[model samples]
Target chain A: MDWHQLWTIISLPDNIPIVGMIFIIPFFTWFGLRQGFANDRLLEKLEGDPKLARAHHRKTQPFQKGWARELPVWPYLLRMEFLAVVIVTFILMVWSITLDAPLEEPANPSLTMNPSKAPWYFLGLQEMLVYFDPWIAGVVMPTLIIIGLIVIPYIDENPLGNGYYTYKQRKFAIWTFIFGFIILWCSMIVIGTLIRGPGWMWFWPGMTWDHNRLIFEINRDLHEIIGITSQPWIGIFGGLVVGGFVTVAGYACHRLIVATEFTRRILGRMSLLQYAILQALLIIMLALPVKILARLLFRIKYVWVTPWFNV
Target chain B: MEASKKAAAKSAPLATNGSNGSRQLLGVTVDPQEIKQKALMDLNAIKQPTKTEVYKSIFRVKHDQTARSRTLGVLSNVFLHLHPARVNRDAVRFSFTWGMGGISFYLFWVLTWTGVLLMFYYHPTKVQAFRDILYLEHDVPFGKLLRNMHRWAAHAMVLTVQLHMFRVFLTGSYKKPRQFNWSVGVILLVLTLLLSFTGYLLPDDQLGFWAVTVGTNMARATPMLGHEGPFGPQFGMTPFNDVRFALLGGSIVDANALLRAYIWHCIAIPGFAATFMIVHFWRVRKDGGISGPNRIMLESEIKPLRR
Candidate 1:
């Protein structure tokens, strides 16, 4: 193992946030879900006993008979805000003092940075370029992501978990978000930052980024593999394959949506339009990982190719 | 000390006698001892600064431990008034909310101040930009620290903003009345990313230059607008007149791109983000404060679909 290579990547000042995210995301996930599970257990107890449910405050937080249910924001909430600011300031100060921000040589159009990457946050999009065309990965995907996030509240039909954390109550919503954010987005960024090296080649952690290395592999379009070599016919066959994949994925999503009685009820609340939008977004989201696996395992590049675009 | 003691002794009886010890000066009757006592009372009020007129004028509320005073303490101040007079007691707990939103705002404030300071030493021209950064690192006092803090806080802001969105999603805080605010928040998230991206190009170093080069290169594939995008050529788009050209102000990352990035980073985007933030916070209160550590509802409570 090239420990020095691994250390060099890890110790790069710009990568600190990703390293921090590796720990922070998991810690906060556990922290949040722990509370969620605790609330679920309490919910079970309260649901079984009607009398206690009536008397109970219904929150996991401790409450006494004489205590006020609300507190003034002045000393109570403001103090917490002040403390958070002070703590953040301290962290930033220490970080700034210890590590210097990166500055390479002056810009020269003649010389290109090998494996030139975008900012760490945009690294996810950069990595997406490997699997799809720039139009899809760069333009369309970002626009869709923002639109999908904006429409989340309007589309989510579940009402049980509103204003509180509960895995049992919000199983579908929580799992979908975890898959999108932690698994897909964050993991891509980490991969782009640490694993992808010179020439955008994949190097396992602790492996040297050998600039001279080359891999001899041939990637083929789905139609090419199927031995079709004509314009309209090739386009028709690829479109059929894409359509089939979508139909199958849509059915799977439908099954998952109606998996439990609670989920079925939630699904019932959604309008037909809402249901369609949700399915469309979910299928597109699922396509990312499916495409990544196709390229990695099977050397498949494009499933669908047309005069205008390839997918 | 002797003069004050003699004056106190002389005024002692007269102060107690009230109007009887008053003497005429000009057309109005005036008492020196009474004036002395009034001045002493004013001095005492000054000692308790909160009771003074200047303090009261600014605060417009008492600082006592009473509920009314406490409520007014937050409601009266322009900065603190963004918060409600009171909040759900459980909402104050760190575990409930995680305080990421507030930390994100604080980091923005830090970035703004540090950014302004760095701007004083920076130049957006092709030749001067790199030298200015070099000068900042080696010559300017604490300039390295200033630039470092700005960069790190920016990274921190992006992380905290994501975590804030994650927490909001995890708690299902975007339901019902909060749907619109959540949309506003998504816009703010985009603005935050754009702000950071624009700032990346200001140093004119290879790292930023190439990062930006790779970034703006994506615009070259924006279907209808970019030259290399599908059908873009059919629509008469080219390297000189495409969306990428508009973004970079030229065919390549050059002096014009640096200036454009500087303007967007320092002026335009911050303005938009701040305006959106105002709406976000306002809607948060209108939507009934922070989505809470509330009682979990049961499955049986699910209402039937309308229509």
Candidate 2:
């Protein structure tokens, strides 16, 4: 086929070509002479020559001497992950069996139900929206959280903690990470679960993440006294730039405060533990907003099969 | 002379055979005639410059490179191709720890695939919603697994996307060139959560109904969304007119909500996400792999020629 006809490979779905791969692979293999591989000296040496095989295998053996190479976090994480997956599956199965929620009405296009809530998971965002304007809940906070997440590997791209304690050396970052996670999450959940009612509230009853939306509004009004651009996009972009600048500058300053080698070691140790806790807190926090929103908006409540098992 | 030539020929094919075993790019096709033409054209393009070399020769042969050379680049030489490389291997670890982003992407893949299968069974309406889910779960082969994988993967994507952010924040990856991407990631993350929200509203069960109710209620609460009376405008639209209409598709949440969420979750949000994600990963590689003070690959070591 000509180039125009050939470009169809690009337009075909991801799998269609992959399916072609299953056949095209062997087609090319035989066409290129699959029977020829046997003629290959390397292949003959690998399979037929004992001495060459032995030499090659021996040369590639791992160096046991390096304390570093023995480290194995990937496997460890994989095992732990498997356990988590199994446990979660078992729990879901049990819940599905026991809860046996009524199928309820058939999906009627015209029907409306009260205490209409979102899926329990989304209660967090739906709940957050209660406090902040749609621009904030639907836009700002969720945006910040995910954008913040995607940057993790970039920030700590250091292969330092590849084995176990990834940030074992960065005590300052550990605390900073944990602190941010906890503060952000706990505040969201607390605000979402407690203040929620007909809508969001800023006081104890049922306000959302921006419980103080009007307060922030007042502050913005005050800032306008000087000359702060209050446009949402401008505010968001400006806030990010300012926050990022301050954080980097702050990290540099803090690095100087705990400058000793021993202190540095101590800091690293603390950072790792804090980092782990922060990881947990993040999971909890992520679950919270959606969960609360789901419950509040959809009336779809969650029953942790074993209340304690719930994150 | 004949015996020596045969022996050398046998050895030559060995290396060539090994080289041929490498994985081809996804869209490459190598027909025999095409290969012959391409190889010859490539040979001419790279041939040592002859005595006729002049200003005219500069544009003549070089501009007309064979498709093969363009596909393969100048890396075909053993020395160059072996060392030819890119993307530090360590960069792969920068993903959200539990494979959330990838999982999300994969879920999208699964959803699209299964969604097609589901389309065979599902029609976008209150009538078809529950039956399709039930049929898929009970009737279709591995339908339950497919549905379960889609549902679980969606949830997992949400979790993973969040964790990914947490990782980025702690590591400070969002500082600069990545900031816009981070912003895009955030948009994608919200879209992911939105996808989950919308998808949940599809099955047309109590779970689906109540979920949309609370979702819309929350939507209405935001001054930008929910308002009331004559002046209640959503995101600046006439009250109950614009955003909610777009969200629910009509005046209230019924079949409209289910249908809207399904379309957006299945089509719109994911399409938007995939578009941005391509940009996200490209921007990432542009920014360079994750950097830190003590990366393993960064340490002074035998830099094995490229991978």
Candidate 3:
């Protein structure tokens, strides 16, 4: 086919924005997994080569006086540091001259901007606001993330893969962080920064920003779909069901952990407290995708909604 | 004639001896030992002549290519204390650390220098903040360059700090005794983000104002500390007493917010981060410098070896 025909074929799903998912999601997923395998192979090669491994160990062995080398820091580190700083300064100077930082009109409280956004760093949390209550998405989740990061070194028992690149040895840590940083955090930021347009709607690359064509989908809560009445008994029953769902889900995850020797070994390294805390955090993270799926499939805005709180 | 010439040469020596005797007779006694000492000093000076004493005293360190002086030079100098006398050869490799940690430090220094200069031209007040920026961009000589450098350096610092964190994580540099340092690094990362965020509000332009608005609104959702947030009533958090209240200094982003951002961006957060950064660097050295290339021996690896 000619270029025109190719363009037309690609443009077929341009109007149907979500249809872009067919091209993006699987492509990135496959690419990510392939890259992961490639890394694993590279790590294996480095690890398996006896001569290379011996040389590496011998070179670094003297420094094992706690991960340091006896080489003088002055000429070595200072020279490197000085060179990097000079180059970086030059680059920054050039870039700063080339582009001006963005400036918009003065702040008007009455005129709320469409697609109001936080700084790029917080765009992940901003995108999370789309799926959950602000309290949970902005505060609780970020707090939990900080806590989890602080506690990782303590909870992680794997002593291997330190000071070197070894994907096979620290696969879980690597993949988990990648999934969080890349898929959850960075992807959301990219989406928030670019794909999101007026009214916080997804405006794909090929599409134009048309405010008139905005589509509003009224979402229903899970309780509303189940036709639960606002009676005292029903409220109690609803609370019970919610509690039951959590307990069952937690138990199922616990069982799955022990069901396989592979998984059991992973958790076997942690104490009961660490395991419980980490598993609970994992479950909370798992709920994010589940809630998104619920919204996509069933048009459920929320699983829980009450006067004081909503989730 | 030959006899007369010999007699004249002998008279010449006698005349030289007679002049020396007359010079001594005038006053000062010259010891033979003193004369010998002067001759020896001159000989020693000739043997080890000074070629670059002025340059050496001013700039060149007393590095005699010996271990003792090298260590002493680094240890004695307050400025050089930041670096150890020696580092792991691998540690100096750009690919190993990606020079990111060092770059972050460089950017921090750049920001500090440019920031102090910018402060000379900037006013944190709402009325003058935007005007000051415009004046700096258009009126003052090299003002725009200084501002741009500061802005870009701030952005660069944030990015480099993140990359540095990623490098540390990937290399598993945070393992073992480095764990506590890792936690401190995490705090530094947060401080970096905070510094960037606080700085975002400084320009008082639309981009900054709304960014600060949206960013601080998240603080309002903080569990017990925000007036509109969860558990607010239990904590008796009003718009006056909430965390967001303390952050913005009010319910809305206004003069107080601008001032607060200025204080934080310019002073508070940097001070906090700098304090941690000192600890971070000190601990890096204390923990035996940047991590080496030794593969972390996990329990699984050890089990195989034991078997």
Candidate 4:
């Protein structure tokens, strides 16, 4: 591509190229390489190669005695800090030159933009507003996220994967966090910032942001799609559906994961409250995938939409 | 005598003997050791160069492999206390920490400095805000660069903070004694977002205005907390008493909202973030310098060989 074409693509709205530089490409590289290294160590351990294991130790941990090498922070940590500063300074200078920050006409409350957007970081929550009402998407879900993030450390008890980068050892935590962050959070932000256009319609990359055009699709609630009425009894049945699903899924997961007597005993050691909270979190996480599928197959807008709230 | 000789050797061997080692600066022979000793003193000391002691001080500590030197090198400095004196070799690896935290801190400083400078040129009012930005572009020298730097640095800071949190999670650094610090980090992350959001409204441009409008409208739907939203009137929420009113100081994004954003962007949010950022870094040291693969790797090394 020509330099002009390349620059246009690089500086596209949401700065998708910058995202790759700052996150996407680097994340996969680090994760992929680390996973490979971990596998190699596992293989060496399995093969009973004492020398290879020692070599691995030497590569990862040079200090034979203590866990740390006791290198002075002056030139080690501080040096890295200096290097990071220089590198960041260089990047910022180039970015500042290449793209000026967006400055539209003076804000007129009377004349709203075609598709006004929140800051890119909040696009996930904004995208949630498309699927649910304001209360649940804006307030309830955000509050849950804060509480969930804070409680993670206290809830996790398995100490095998502390202070390490072992994918196999900490698969549950790693995968769950990745799914929550990349899929639920980052992908939604990408969609909200890049794809959503005038009148909040989906626009592909090649599509123009034409205000005159109207995008149409039928969006329905789960009850309507399933041929049910929105009466009190139907609402109760809907609640029962969710409750039953959770119970069945939780039981099956327990049976599958807690296979041995030893494993069951270990799980039984957890406090009742912790176990309950964990099950609720698992249900919420699993519900996202189900919600996405429901939307795709039946154009479901919300699974539960009460007078006060929607989910 | 032996210690002095060793210190001299460590500081500079060939320099001590060479004629070029000691030079005349303004007709005075400049002693490297004396300069080092003077540097050891606190900032309060304002003695003349000649008046300061010529003896070796802690700052004169040359390149030595002793534990005390290593510890003293970090402890004796005012700026270095944020970091542990001695970190594990693995902790300083580029890919390990990814230097995201450091980059975030650097970007914060850049934004703060540029924001302060830009404050001299820009005003917060609706009438003056847009005009001030235009003036900054065409009238004020280097104003464009300063504003752009502040803007981009704000964006970069947000990105880096998220990346730092991701690294911490990916490495499983937020566990046990570090749990509280992780919560503090979460607060800092939220505050970073808040800081960036507040700054977004300062330009008085259409992008920021409509963004603030759409964003604050989301607040209006805050259940019983907003008057105009779904469940607010069911409770006692009124136009004057709702959370949206509390945030905007009125119903709409007007002069009050703009002023509040300016104050928050300049002072309040940044102040809160700085306080929490300090705690976050301090907790990292207290919980053991940047969690490493050391513990697990050591375990693997010590484990009996198995086929």
Candidate 5:
């Protein structure tokens, strides 16, 4: 293993955030879920004893007979905020002193940067360019992601877990978020930053970036693999395949939404429009991994192709 | 002699009215012993500065340990007033909210101050931008440190904002009354990204130039607006008059693009982002402060759906 090569990538000033993120994301996730699980255990205890539920404060936080439910912002919250500011300033000061921001040679349109990447945050979208057209990856996907996030509260009809963390109470919501944010968005950014090297080729973590390397893999469209050459037939077959995948995926998401009695009750609360939007978003989200798998494992390129676009 | 007699008459009644037995004539009072005692008392009160007129004028409230003073401490100050006078006892715990939102705001302030300082040395023209950065790094006093702080704080802000959103989602803080504020937050998130993207082009270095080139190239495939996008040609879009052109101000990343990015980064987008941030924080207060680490509700207690 080329430990030097791995170190070079990790030690790059711009890559530090992603490296930090690798630990920060999981640490925070575990930190949050730990509280969630603790709340769940408390929830179980309260559910079994209605008398304690009525008398008890119902929060995991310690309480006494006459303690105030709220604290003064002057000394309590303000002190915390002041401490946070000081801590953040210290971190920023040390970071700025130690590491220099990157500045390369003067910009020349004639010379191109091999494997030119966007800011670390946009790397997830840049990575999507490998699997889809720029229109879909760059424009449509970001728009959809923003819209989906905006509509989350309007779409989520479950009322049990409001204002608190509880994995058992918000199993579907929490899992979906983990899958979308932690698994999809963050992992893609990590892959784009560390794994994808010169010429935009995949290099294992410790592998040297060989600029002259070449792979002879041949990728084919789904219709082409099935030997459909005519224009009308190709379009029709591709459409059918895409439609079938959507139908199956939609059915699976529906089944999961109605999996438990609690979920079914939550699902019942959603209006038809809410349900439809949720399913559409879920299907589109699932399509990304499906397409990635198709391209990686089977060397399948486009599943659907037309004069206007390809998917 | 007549004026002196009239002044004495006026002063004699005022002397009787004065509790300290000071004599007054017209607007002037003459009482050496009383004035000396009053001055001594004032000097003594200065030891407790909070009781002084100057401090009270600015603060407009007592600084004693009373509960009223504590509440007014947060409620009366312009900056601190954004926070309510009181909050849930558990909300102050670092584990509850992770304190990411406040950190994100702090970083924004850091970026603003550093960015303003950097701007004093920067010129946005194509000829000067790169050289200015080099000058900043090599010659300007603490310019390198200033720029580094701005850059790192920006990166830090982005991470913290995302984590803040994640925490909000995990705690289900976006439910019910907070739904609209959450939407506002998503817009703020977009603005934050755009702000970072625009700033990336300011240095005019190859790293920034090409990174921007790759980023804006994607806009060229924006379905109906871009020249190369599907049906774009049919709608009369071209390299000279497309969405990408609007973004770059030309067919390629050039002088115009640099100017555009500079304007957006330093002026327009910050203005927009600041406005949205105002709305976001205001709504947070209106929506009942930070959504809690409240008691978890049982599934059996699910309220009936309001048709």
Candidate 6:
């Protein structure tokens, strides 16, 4: 099809006038103006007014504020968001299960093969990561970007529109922002393409990674990276079973201990009494396993960042 | 006044006294030849709020200000489909703002729904991802709406974020007190966009495939894409072999890229974004509660714009 055909295919709905939508969509959208007249309180409350009473009093309820109103089951979260995801996941699962093609075998490394990309979402980053050094692309950049994000509210102290900015007013912010966008993230997309090839994307032996880099059991390089010796005991049983458990347990314990110290003696009055108990139990539950596993198998050197989930 | 009402009835039967029907005001009746002079008097009543009444209205526990809250108030009076109130009624108002770690739980909620639904039929492999999308559009139940909402919400999240940025900038909210958080918001925005763009490519159609190809090629223009690019001769690397291979999850858009995109879209980036959003909101609450600059436009000013 021609470009014109593509344009026809993507045209906005008829109700949205072409020229008007450009200016209208943002303003009307931000104001939520089209939420309809009945959705406004002044209009609804006017139902008692002699002029527009019949037209008001909200035939339907207007949403309320403060801590007093009843809320949807998920609170701030929307029902549709979950619904849309669940329905789609199941549908995709069914479609894939029934399809004729085979899921390629347990991923092979020796096969100097075709198409070795990460998940497509990361492909954009992996595609970008190709340009930079490995440490920068894979480790330093992603971590810093994420950590940097944790400080947003502390940085943008503007208490105004809650969510609106003009280009000029936001120049420094907009300019510095481009680094994360066009540079770092785009590099991540490049990484998958540039970094992968046969073995760990490196010529070294312990470039150890399972298909999709699953690292079901941590290996020598991973151990050395964590400043620990590569013991067969740790590799077989300790790392595989005990290490995972104890690490998670230790973190749980730390969180619990912290919580307990902070809790007041008068718990019965606080609604959080149950929550505090639950958190304490979780700590014990995790800590016990760490103790038991360390005694049973090889010792865990330290609580290092795991290959999966980055922590 | 009753006399004027009778006289106006001779022409416009619905005219009421002291309404727009009066031919004379303050005894300055204009002549028939110069009736136009009379038509020009300020043709409206000032909707002036009494100071006493306005103050009473302000404290009237019922009429709390804020556009979103007011909208909900109206919705509550009539249609009762949504859940009942929960005391913290204003939670959903800033539902659009993703605060610190860069996004709200709501956006994650949106991502999860759209991501999972897309995953149901999506193949992480190049050949099938596009077909799956086609199946979703043409075959699945309510699939189009799901896809459309997913796409639109992603777009809305982007736009809202930009607006959120503007709100910060205009208010000078991203200053010393909010600088780091501002930077974080910027990163989150980038991540959000990256998430949206890669998902766009997952379908594996010409649009999806070529867009990635072209987009990456533009990046390769930055002294990469290897040796085959326009500047590849200068850089001394094979063009297609240089930068392009890293993109397609193999040599082309294939299983690897799809799977990678799926994993990141469903998990990693979102995981990171969520962690940050929590911190962002928490800090906002601790720092001084969410910023509430007097940002509402006056109705009278709005009326002129409307006309």
lDDT of 6: 0.44
Q: Model 5 reaches what TM-score against the true structure?
A: 0.94
Model 1 per-residue lDDT tens digits across residues A1-311:
99999999999999999999999999999999999999999989988987888888989999999999899998999888888888898999899999999999999889999989999999999999999999999999999999999999999988788888899899999999999999999999999999999999999999999999998989999889989999899899989998998999999999999999888988888999999999999999999999999999999999889998888
Candidate 4 lDDT over B265-293, as tens digits, reads: 99999899889988888888888767775
**Backbone steric clashes in candidate 3, count:** 9
For model 6, fnat equals 0.13
Candidate rank order under TM-score: 5, 1, 4, 3, 2, 6
Pairs that collide in candidate 4 are none
Among all candidates shown, the one with the greatest DockQ: 5
Candidate 2 per-residue lDDT over residues A164-236, each given as its tens digit? 1233334444554554454444344433433343324334432223423543222122123334454554455
> Measured by TM-score, how close is model 2 to the native structure?
0.46
Tens-digit lDDT string for candidate 4 (A1-311): 24544454346634643455446635654764484367447744744766665555534444575555557787767877887788889988987777777778988888988788888888888888776677767877787788888878876654545666666555566766877877788788777876787887876655666679965778987778778885775576667777777887788656644666534543555567867776677676666667667776778886665665556
Give the Å error, residue B209, model 6: 1.2
Task: Give the distance in Å from residue B156's predicted Cα in candidate 3 to where it truly belongs.
Answer: 2.2
- In candidate 6, which residue ranges exceed 4 Å CA deviation? A1-21, A24-311, B1-105, B224-244, B294-307
The two-chain DockQ for each candidate, comma-separated, is: 0.71, 0.09, 0.31, 0.35, 0.75, 0.06
Model 1 residue runs over 4 Å out of place are: B1-46
What candidate 5 gets wrong by more than 4 Å, as runs, is B1-46
What value does the interface RMSD of model 2 take? Answer: 15.0
Give the TM-score (vs. native) of candidate 6.
0.38
Worst 10 residues of 1 chain B by lDDT: B10-19
Give all candidates' CA lDDT scores: 0.93, 0.48, 0.72, 0.74, 0.92, 0.44
Weakest 10 consecutive residues of candidate 5 chain A by summed lDDT: A157-166
| Per-residue lDDT of model 6, residues A69-141, tens digit only | 4344232434443554465446444533432221233323233333444432345434433333233344434
Docking category of candidate 2: incorrect
Candidate 6 lDDT by residue in tens digits, B53-158? 5544553324445545544554454322133332233334432232311333355566578778767777676556656766787899967666665654564455
Please provide TM-scores computed only on chain A for all of the candidate models, following their numbering: 0.99, 0.37, 0.75, 0.82, 0.99, 0.31
